[model samples]
Target chain A: MKRRIGAAGLSLFISATLVITGCAQQKILDKMGLSVVIGYDRVDKDRLLGTNVLHQFDPMASESVQIVASTAYTSKGTRDKSNLEMAKKAVSGQLRVTLYSEQLAKEGIINLVDTLARDPTIGARVFLAISKGRAHDILKHRYPEFGNIGTYMYQTISQNIEGESMISPTLHDFMHDYSSVGRDTILPYLEQRGKEGNELVISGAALFQQDRMVGVIPTKEVFYVKLLRDRFQAGSIEISIPREVLGKYMKVSQKKRGNDPIFLVLDTLSSSSTFKLVDKNRPQINTEIKITGRLQEVSEVVDLSKPEIIHKIEKAISQAMMNEGNKVIAKLQKLETDPIGFGEIYRSSVRHSNLTRDKWYEMYRDAKLNLKVEMTLVRTGVIE
Target chain B: MKSIGKPGEHQVFSTFFLFWVIIESQIGMGILQFQRKVVQVAHHDAWISVLITGGVIHVVVWFMIRTLAKYESADLYEIHQHALGKWIGNLLSILYMAYLLLLGTLVLRSYIEVVQTWLFPEIPTWLLSSSVLLLTVYGVLGGIRIIVGVCILSYLFSIALLFFLAYNLPYADWRSLSPVMEANFQELIIGAKQMAFTVVGFEIIYFVYPYLKEKKKAGRYTQMGVLYTTLIYCLVLVLSIAFFSEGQIKKTVWPSLSLFKIVQIPFLERFEYVTVSLWLLVIVPNLLLYLWAATRGMKKVFHWNQRRSVYLSAALVLAICLLLKTNLQIKFLGEWAGQLSLYLVFVYPVILYFIVLIRTRKQRKEVK
Candidate 1:
């Protein structure tokens, strides 16, 4: 009887404790406001403009996203002020993309990026991009196809990166590169293309010296930059062969008539790049890039069936890639940015030396780059 | 002296169960921040420091087991009373109990800090502390057998989290750990010293030794437990070094959790949130085992009821956790507890081993 009473009292205590603690206030799906994409733009020297597209799942309303803009001294301050106007609590847990205007990115993004990094709700995979124009305008604009601009922009940037068109950097990746001694990070540079400004396009990539954007490279050149920085899995490059070089491989009549351009688009199957610091004091980099791909398209028909002709095409492609790679390296060197992580390679190779970031930057500016490109054309498509 | 355990209850834990208890206790809140702390001292050579610390801990474990083996079925408390005499031994036993209590409090406070920083920010401290302490109390009330069961279950559930390290491999740059052995001897020693906090909890074996079913094989099993912990710590330390840059590792508060940031799954958006929640399983056993050891110590030394000691210690731990409100205060608490543990677990064990050696030799001479 005593044991039974003790058991009953223990159960009562357990239930009572559970009842008193209650449940955490449930955030109903309909009432909660989720911000998927946030944008930051420079307003002035002291103040800043913050914009976000709040994803609302309304059972009654037709629209699902609201673009709210506010001015504040800091990112959190802006969120708190924006919260006063919203119908529900604005949460950033589902934040998929964050945009920074080029102006703000140039002034420095470390502080804002730190805010995002410090937030536990925001994942490291959230896309971070730099807008060519005002980031606020990008968030405010609407497209007919995408009902929700936030998810649409996120998918757009994510897919382009997966498609190997632009380099996709998350907030964590940016912070990693920004904090690392020998490396600088690049972000997808987005611009409003066409006269209507209705279309948001990922145009090129913005390079950072540290936390600040130093320069932007054109979209075409970004391909070479990626080749120098990362291994390639599935990206295509179009090389325009000189008419004279094409004539050497085929009949003049087959090369097409006057003023017609001949192009070869190679779809990369696999590629790898190796960076070696051959000279420590002078800091000379030997970059070897091996690319294996199949010829996808040719504007003018050239006989790729013969081994000699294939060899000549390979030579031409390697020469073209080497020149392009050199140009990209020169541009990065002129900007004094080591986005290729040449400094990291140098640091790894040398030992027992005190190499500061400043010293590495100086070396990067004066460093000489030697590029070697190896191209293997495996197949010329199904049509020969 | 009265036997602390019933005849059948004394042998409830098998050799394998002993392994799990040592490992579960050794890897608590420390694993989350150990990489950052070690890296701050040794830089890229932190893995080497970890290995050195592992070797030293193996020697220390050997000494502790040897000392415990001198007594037939006596634990550290009984051994102290027998070897050091009544007053001095009782005083040292009290210090050990206080040390165990502080260790439990540090683990709870650190786990709460991680939860507050990572999961629920608005929840009050006393609420979280009470919940964890209640769970701990429940496990302790079940006694050592049930606590070992929880340890076995927690080991099974959380061991797979180590596999998540593979997800970070793609981002890992082997070059970050290159030019190894760069740290001087002093720096490496400091790094190993920093690891003492994370590695100290295995010393609970001195208290748990007498309860093992196969006391003869306890030495091998306990060493295996410490070996497993060393391997895990080394694996995590190396992975953190390879994943983060040297400068980044030093700045990160919780390198282990931060490394999980790179993990992306289709269904889960924030993997760290899931990891932090699952980490509760890993944390409960540490709190349960250490608090149980403390309560057991108090019961033996002061002739208090075991249940009363458990309640008193649990309340003390909860109060300490509540009082350590700020990050700086919690950090100081952790540092002091670590320093105290270094003396109690490392330095004191060696001294006690010598004392036990002399006492046994003198007793043999008198018998002759």
Candidate 2:
């Protein structure tokens, strides 16, 4: 009889435990608000104009509509204030993309990044990009053509991975580059391109010294920068040489800039760059650039492919690379953004130099550079 | 010494559980904010300091094992009573108990602060602290064997948490770890000092020594545990450093969790939530072991019953944790406590070892 009483009591306790465990919240998909994109721009000393793209598929509208809202205040205040502005509860659990304006980025994004980083609500998977124009313009651009401006912007930049013109920078990567001494930073630059009857596009990239934007490189130059930075995976480049220079070659490729002339199109078939820090005491920087490319198409095809002609094509391409490489190097030196990773080279080769910020910038302008381009003409387009 | 039907038989842990206890207890809340503390000294070479500290702790564990083996049946409290006179021994033992209680509460307080600041803004701070502490007391009440067993199980789940973090590799830049050893040797040593706080749990052998079924192999177990814990700690530390550069690490409060937040799955998002949940599992062993030590010390010094003393001590700790005013205060207390306890955990053991050695040599010479 006593044993039966003990068993009955144990059953009641077990049932009660089950009830409590059942009541404890286990997160469900329906309970979460999936935020795919977040945009931040500095409004004033104490306020951050924050905007986010929350994805929603409205069955009534018969299409996907992303809810966009802007709240202006400090991070803590904005977070609280945005809660009331949101249609449904704003959940940053799925935030994948964080967009910063050129102004906010140049002003040093570390403070803004700190807010996102410190908050547990924001997902770490969020990719970071810098808007070339106003962040609000990018955030508010109603491409009624595309479902969501934020989604379109994020997808457009990410697709450049295959092209290798611009790197898809994550919030973590941006922070890393921002902190590294030997390197400045680059962000996939976005600007709302296109006018009426066309959809806005986010393309190209921006180069920065630490946190401040020093200059903007168009999509074409961004490719070369990526190559120098060793971030290039697969991208194409075209250099044009004069027709007279091409006459010595069977076939020569060219890219026309406003129809002014022709430079040989050394369609960047493949390229690799390496940095060497020789003579730490002398404070020298040497970069060896090797590019292998095929003459895909010739503006003027001279004759059947010949060995002499091919050699002429190779020489011309080499000279062109040196000129273009110098131009890029000059621009980088002027800006003092070591997107070429000279600081990293210094760290690796001259481990004991103890180079400080001012010293590195001084050395960078005077650094020696070596450029080498190797070209192989596989065939003359689709013909001999 | 009352007959309990073979206590050692009930105390032997499976190799799996032993591995779990080491990893979970070693990780603690330190894994979240550890890099910031170390970077203040070591800069980028903090990972190396971790390796050196691991080696140092291994040697400390060896000496501790030798001391324990010589004493045979005696644990830390018993050894203190034998080596020092009753009054002094009891006083020092009281110090150890106070340190353990404070350490456990600090862990609870810091975790509450993190949760309140990050996840649930609406929830009251005391409620979260109470809920976590209540669960901790449940494990503490289960005794040492059950605590170790739960640690093993929770460790398996926590190790699986690494899979999500490991997925962020495509985003990792190997160069970020470069400019290697740029921060000189002195900086690295400071980093080693910081790493010691994160790796503090192995000294629990002082309390659990008598519970080992194979008393002779207790040293081997401790070595294996420390090694496994070191590997995980270093792995996470390296991943954090490689993913974020020195500047980024300095600003990041919880690098490991941040790494998880960056990692996304095709089917689901918000990995940080899962990471926090898993961390809850990992910190439980740290809480249980500390509470167990506090209870065991009370039993020895005050002759208090185990059940009554554990409940009373846990209640007092909970109250103290609740009273800890602000997040900054809790952090300040935790850091100061860790630094103070370092003297007890690292310095005191070495001092005691030498004193015991001198006494033993003198006794032998007298006999001869």
Candidate 3:
């Protein structure tokens, strides 16, 4: 009986000790003022000023609202130093959008990227965008419709690419392209518009040549660039064909419209890219862009299901692709950047130790593009 | 000695448990660090090496079961005594015990290191290692049946842990797996050699064979364990390759851990913290299994009580773990041990099986 009591007492003692330890080791959620968005710009020599946008959710409120502000000259003089200083309280774990000024990106971000990649706190999946205007000014602007403009603008830019005009570039996708040998990095460019109640507009895409921002493309070509890069989704493509070409092609098919230039809106487009290395030594690159698209709607359509109408649309797609492809290629060639990741193909396929940056530029300058348009107008919508 | 007795006659393990035991033991510490070693040799086709080594495992496990089945009541030490001379057999048994001890200690230390890096940075290494040791010793005290029960419980935790890898799918670049079979056949063979550490631990069955209620089912159970282990580790390996590029995998120290850290939970900021927390359940069972084997071997070879053998062996392993200072040093030691274990676990068993086979035939001829 005494031994049984002694054993029971010992179990109680151990249980009590365990309870105390468990309570002591309780993981306290350190409310370190989680920053949702951060923007960086070059300030002085070897110094950078950073702004972090923070959000605090009020539990009592019906809907979650956010707080936005700018904190500059955060202790660390350099970009990495500034990031680390901000990271202490910012909670980069929740950070979704990271915007960089054009000047800072143009200066070269390999060093800054290395720091971001090495840090455990900063997420690799966050969206990276290049601001067309001052990144600080864009961050400072607030939209009356969205309470927290930082998150609002970030999501607005990303979500718009589905149905509207934009290019979606997540941090993961950006990093993949940036690290690839043939491909360069691209980011959706946004800027503040108007003076009073400023609105952020998604411009085109900022193209980079090995971590250095080289040039930009407008929203018109941004669609074509994305299509060529195989980033197409459910978005409409607007094409304007001269009245003469429209008349020449559409005259064969049915009840023709009276007398306006045909404006074709193409949707549900899918593009496939195939590349071949012609010569391994002085390597000549051949790229084939095949597009599959359906006609969503037309401004002046006489017949929807006619073979001639499909032929006209196909020709229009071909012409549109050629014009847009040339504009993008010319710009890329001028900037000596391959944002399509063609350089990656070269690096992966042809094993050449002597192939330097200058050699790649020289080779890419001469690489040819073949555009093939295969449009299947499966349905002309309910209007037809 | 208290007996939990044979797992009740009706208590057959579920196929899932067989699958779980195999995969859980296989996937342990190797998931985090084996990539570099294999890639160093195999380059792009290291996965082929994995397949080849898996075949090698099938053969080794078969031989191990055949050798252990020779004696119904004994283990590796007894088999060695019967096959080889008593003195040499005892010496080999001691070496085997030491190997198991070193392995357990290294795994324990590395687990603590992971805990330090990912979770409680301020916690002392001794405290973490001691706590794990305390739990493992408690489990070990319950004997083999209870240890296997803890392993079964830990398997459920492993399934939950696997969900964390799904978050990495968004970042996975399929191009990283391109240029498949870039390495030649020789490099592929070398890659398989590095997988030796990943596929080991089923050798624990030699000691465990006696404790099993149904000895005939032991072979099937052991094979099931290994196959499951290979499947799990292979899935992890493929995930790492898919998530990170070859260049990136070569640079990262702990690719599996890095993969987990990338997972951002809606409610929890650091999900790897949750993974590291559950990781204790996995590593403790593994450590306890290895430690029990060492103690059991020591008792058999030296004619000592298991209590004395266990205390002395655990002390030695603890001392060795305390000696290692940094992660790099631990890595270096682990690599060297892996290389040695290839011989101890694989080559030695195959050679012994052949020798025993030839001897048994000769004895039968002489008796006729």
Candidate 4:
């Protein structure tokens, strides 16, 4: 009993001693400035310009938010520089979005992105996008609707990513594609629009070869990229069909809009794509896409009561998808970007392929895309 | 005093405890980053090396159990005394005890390194090491049953710990697993050798043998533990290979933790941060098991009370943990420990089993 008491006392003493030592550093929320969104622009070969949008919660402060622009040679350097310029310590624990200028992304952003990837504080879910011009301009604009530029852009990208219209541009995906030999990084392309430039528009996706932006494709074509590259559920797409296929079943009131392609919107879409290397010698890829969805809208209304109409719609949609798929693949080939990962299929499907980035890029230009699409119109909304 | 420790009945535990003991011992801080070193040599086919090394573990463990089963309630120390005689046996036991202490030190120091880097970067090494050492000392004093209970908890923690890797599944590019047999036999052999430290710690079975109530079933259950560990290592290796690109895995210091860096959960902004903290449960059992074995060595070989040895060993490990100033030094210590474990845990056991067999045969003939 005496020994037990002694052991308990010793444990308590040790705990007390260590607790009092207080080795780890503590950062109180009030003392530190939390950066939510950071923007980067390349000024020269050796210098970088960065804009830090910090969140302000202090009631005593005059400004509603804090925006500090610092010029540095590295991303961490900018954070450190901005910290010196601020009233409080700058911390990236709440960093939600990172934006790169088109010029900076064109010059290659790996040297800039490496710091965030290496740091433990920055999360993998942080949104990454490319501004059409200078990222500083986009980050500097304080829109009336948004309180914080960082979270506003993050939510914008996050919502679209969840809805299936936007390609995922998270830091994790960027690093994955950046290092992957067979795939390239794709990021949301942002442009400040409207008369006063108060509105932020995610106009397209910026395609990257290695870390440099090689080309930009509008959101309309990005739908085809999504169809080929990713699996989607409850995703909606608006397709423009020629009047020739749908004119027969057209609603009488819609005849005034003659020769304009019929618009069809499909919602609650579940799509699966399969890529198989049928011929490995020349890197020919056979892609099979199966899509099932309910028709939510049609510009020229078609009779939904007939099985013949569904068959015609399927054939017409399949034809339209095949043509768009061909165009996207051709554009990707021209851009020398393998975002569809045909090169990955080559490397994975073959033994001792020993694929290097440059080598795969060369083969990717000539790689045949054998495309097939099977669309199943499951329901015609609540009507049918 | 007898060469073997004969603890009271309350200290002894059931045979199922051996299963958790083997697993809890083998999987520790090593699993956090072993893939980095392993993939360096074997490239994408590193999982094959992990598989081959796992096969060799069964043979090594069989040798250990066979040698220990030859005597009633005798452990590594007793077997050393019986086969090699007094002075030499005590010296060997002493070295093994020190190695066990060093094993504890390695676990403590590496865990501190992880915490310092990943979670609380400002925490001084002395405070954290002493804190962990104190906890280990407190746990070990409860004896083998208490250590086994901790090991059981560690089993659940290990599952949740590695389950963090599953979060990287959607982005997993499994094609990296293709061109699987590209690694030459030599590279595979080198890679398998590199996995030594990670798959080790099953050697504790030799030390814990006397504390088991059903020693007869120890071999079968012990083998089961190793089998499951192999399955887990393979599964993790496969997942890691599929999850990370070849170039990316090469750059990653801790492939397992880095796998969680990409996990996007609603409630947890940074999942790896939470992972680093919960890791305390996993490493605590390891510290307890090794500390217990080393203290038991003190009681058996030097006739010191376990209570005295527990504090002494924990302090020694804590001192090393604080004194190692840099991660480079800690890494160097780990390499040295890894090489030593190769000889002591893997090669030496089979040789000892032979000596035990020969010595016992000779003694029977002399008695006749």
Task: Give stretches of model 1 more than 4 Å off.
Answer: A1-384, B1-11
User: Per-residue CA lDDT of candidate 1, range B1-368, in tens?
Assistant: 23344336654688778889989989988998888789989999999899999998999999998998887777888888878998999999999988888888988888887887777644667999999899999999988889889999999999988888799999989998989899999999999999988888888888777778877898898889999999999999999999988877766778899888888889877788888889999999999988888899888888899899889999999888888855556776788888888888889999999998999899889989
Interface RMSD (Å) of model 1? 27.0
Quality of model 3 by C-alpha lDDT: 0.70
Q: State which docking tier applies to candidate 1.
A: incorrect
Summing lDDT over every window of 10 consecutive residues in candidate 2 chain B, give the lowest-scoring window. Answer: B1-10
What local lDDT score does residue B317 receive in model 1, on the 0 to 100 scale? 93
Stretch of 10 with least lDDT, candidate 4 chain B: B1-10
| Interface DockQ per candidate | 0.01, 0.01, 0.01, 0.01
Q: Where is model 3 more than 4 Å wrong at Cα?
A: A1-384, B1-22, B362-368
TM-score, chain B, model 4, is: 0.97
- lDDT for B368 (candidate 4): 90
Q: Estimate each model's TM-score.
A: 0.51, 0.49, 0.48, 0.51
Q: Where does candidate 1 chain A have its weakest 10-residue lDDT segment? A: A375-384
Summarize candidate 1's per-residue lDDT along A1-384 as a digit string, tens digits.
Answer: 999999999999999998889767787766777899999999989788989789867767787798888999999888888988899888898999999999999988999999899999889999999999899988887776668889888999889888787765988789888888788999999898766688888888999999989999988888888888787787788886556655676675675587554678987446898888888999998999998776778887665545576777778788888988899999999998878788788888899657678988888888889999998875553222
TM-score, structure 1 vs. true: 0.51
Candidate 2: docking tier = incorrect
lDDT of 2 at B3: 17
Candidate 4 residue-wise lDDT at A302: 70
Model 3 clash pairs are A35-A90, A181-A344, A182-A343, A182-A344, A183-A341, B22-B225, B22-B229, B23-B229
Clash counts for all predictions: 0, 14, 8, 0
Candidate 2 residues lying further than 4 Å off, grouped into runs, are A1-384, B1-8, B12-17, B360-368
Q: Give the TM-score comparing model 3 with the true structure, all chains together.
A: 0.48
